[model samples]
Target chain A: MRDKVVTAAEALAEVRDGALVAFNFWGPGTPLHLMRALQERGVKDLTICTNNYTLRADVLREQGAVDAAILLPQTRKIIVAFSGVQQEDSSASVEIARRVQEGTLEIENVSHGLFIERLHAGAMHLGGIYSPIGIGTSLENGKEKRVINGVEYLFQEPIVPDLGLINAAKADTLGNLVCHGTARAANPVIAMASRYTVAEVFEVVEPGGLDPDTIVIPASFVDRIVRIPDDDPYSRERRVEQTLRSVKYRLEKMAEAEAEAAQGGGA
Target chain B: MKEKLTEELVAMRAAKELVPGDYCNLGIGIPLNCAAYAAEGVLLESENGVLGYGPVHDRESLDENIERVDWDIADAGMRYLEYVPGMSFFDMLTSFAMIRSGRLISILGGLQVSEKGDAAIHSTSKDDIASKIGGSMDLSWGAKRLIVTMTHCSKDGSPKIVRELTMPVTTRGRVNLIVTDMAVIEVTSSGLVLKEFAPGWTPEEIQEQTEATLTIAPDVREMEF
Candidate 1:
């Protein structure tokens, strides 16, 4: 098997301007190293397709670290399942909100299932999928529609991404990937759908060391593997600790503000 | 009948629809409260890719070391309920496959539901740039049964159970049952049926709050906890 190990910069170098990139934004599967490298590369007009575009604010608030470095000014469009704030007092990513207002960023909100199915269509080399999910919603505004069995269904075309940046728990020399726990999210499907797939793993082992049954993605689907360094701040344990500390800090700050308010009210 | 039911009572009433061994998806908001009231053997599924979840863990009650074993924390770092045996996690494709294949019953919250069983839950009129659809459209279209739980009226005193949805429709003709603070209604081929009302609420009172004309069931009774 051909060796797939490469530096994160080398792997990210393959991406160019105006490329459609499919990414896994869920939990441990977020490819933080590649994302930072992409940010450093400063590619423009990239369309990011993912489940949620609020990863930047979520991570910053929860972990006090930045994993969604891709949510920068260079991103011209986003096809996501969820976007914007839901509650009156709650807030979304300020940058994203500002971009949308300035007409610099375009967003298409699809349901989570349709988002995955569109990727599945690309992976399967099929034309598109027919589903009734968005038949009557704004999601169906410009999409092709067909009536089958007297029920209307929307025709969602395949989203063939130019690059797939995914994360995995372990990878063999040949780039066969295995994900631990819930980190296996969108990585498997996005890896198959993109023209070039780069994987960032916590550990890289010799070929055949990974159990055959444990491999979630095969070498054929992966073009490169970038092993994250041991001391990386994005490491699972470190991120968790940082997140807990940030939570405690925020709570303490809130308590202090409350105490100050009480003192003023008493005076 | 009682004047108005509590949110927990509304969820508890909705839980009565779940049968043992049923695979279910509970949306955020009031539908999430159904987890605590669900009957035994009803497996709960989360759209972020978890199945067979138990009741959500109380932050104060969680024993980090012991409870962490069976629980799977979501990507957002929110701890889900303890996991039941046979629980599994997969990628988004597999999770959504179960939803699109109609293998799970979906319980969701809605902004408005029309008499024709159409539901509008995703975006409000004020949201212009990003609609924030989430998984509501998928869950509405794909689930075997789509049960909606929400307050009967919006905070502005407008009815949510209406003759025609004023909000953007998430999915048309998908809602099966609606459990609200005021009443429990079923969407039938004939139209919206008022099956039961809160303890202090009469069928006439619920009708006054509802925008749609309701056909009170012949066997209608006061909601039981």
Candidate 2:
């Protein structure tokens, strides 16, 4: 078998400007090491396809050392289910808000199901999918609409990205991936949709180490693997710390909202 | 009603609407609370690919050993999810295929519901910043039944059950039922029908707050819970 293990920088070295990148931004499956490498590589005008764009910003904010400046400029457009300011107090990713206002960044806001389905179409080598989800909503603004069996369905084209970035719990030397708990989110689908899939894993074992049944993503779908060092800044412990910090930040925002409401009136 | 129903009570009432063996999708906010009140055999599904999820694992209730395993609690929608015996996880594609197939009943939080059954939940008129559009569109449009759970009025004393939505529509003519702090209403060809009101609240009182014309059910009574 070809050696798939590579450094984060080596794995991401080929990413170019204007490349479409499919990212797993759901929960802990976000490939922060690859993201950091991409930020440092300074590739510009990239289009990111992900579930939520604010998650990376949230993690950086919780870390308190870095800001959105590193990643915002790299992204020219984001096709996602959730984008923009999240709360009444402006608690969401500031970079997204700023870019959207400046008209520098474009957003194609589709429903979560459609977002996944689009990627799935790409992965499965299907031309497109017809669904009733976006029918009369803004999601169907420019999409082809078809009536099948007396039901309106919107035709969504496939989304094939140039690169796919994902994080996983473990990977065999051959690039078979095993996700931990709910962190598996969109990694498996993303792996199949991109031309090159780079997996950043916590551990890399021998070829026969990972159980076949436990491997959610096969080696055939992965092009490269980067093992995150135990003491790396983006290790599991660091992610947990960042998550807790984000929770604390959210609680604080909620408290502040409550205080402001109390000041307004009893109602 | 003498006092508005608590968020938990509103969720409890919404939970009662779910039948056994139903596949349900609960949105963020008030709908997330419904997991606690779910009926037997009602499996909760998340858009991120989890099924048969149980109620939130309160820190107090979680086993000490399990708490040590780092779980991403930043996403409030998934923070409270407890893995059950038959829990299964899949890719987002499969998760959404189940949703778009109209096999799941969606319980969602809404900003406004028009008499025509159109719902506006994604964006608000006051949003000068970028608008956030989550799974509201798909859940509303493709779910077998869309149940909207929200407070009757906004914080500024405006009725959410309006004749027409002032905000951008999330999905057109998709809402099946509207559950609020004051009343439970069903949207039908005739318009918003007042099915049940909270204790001490009359149809007239609910009508006073609702912008849409309400037709009181023939057997309208106080909510059982």
Best by lDDT: 2
Q: Show how many residue pairs clash in every candidate, following the order shown.
A: 4, 1
Runs in model 1 lying further than 4 Å from the true structure:
A55-64, A67-70, A85-92, A245-267, B1-3, B55-77, B81-83
TM-score of each: 0.90, 0.92
Docking class of 2: medium
Q: Rate the local accuracy (lDDT) of all candidates.
A: 0.80, 0.80
In Å, residue A116's CA in model 1 sits off its true spot by 0.5
Two-chain DockQ for each candidate model: 0.50, 0.51
Q: What is the lDDT of residue A180 in candidate 1?
A: 69
Leading candidate by DockQ: 2
For candidate 2, the share of real interface contacts preserved is 0.54
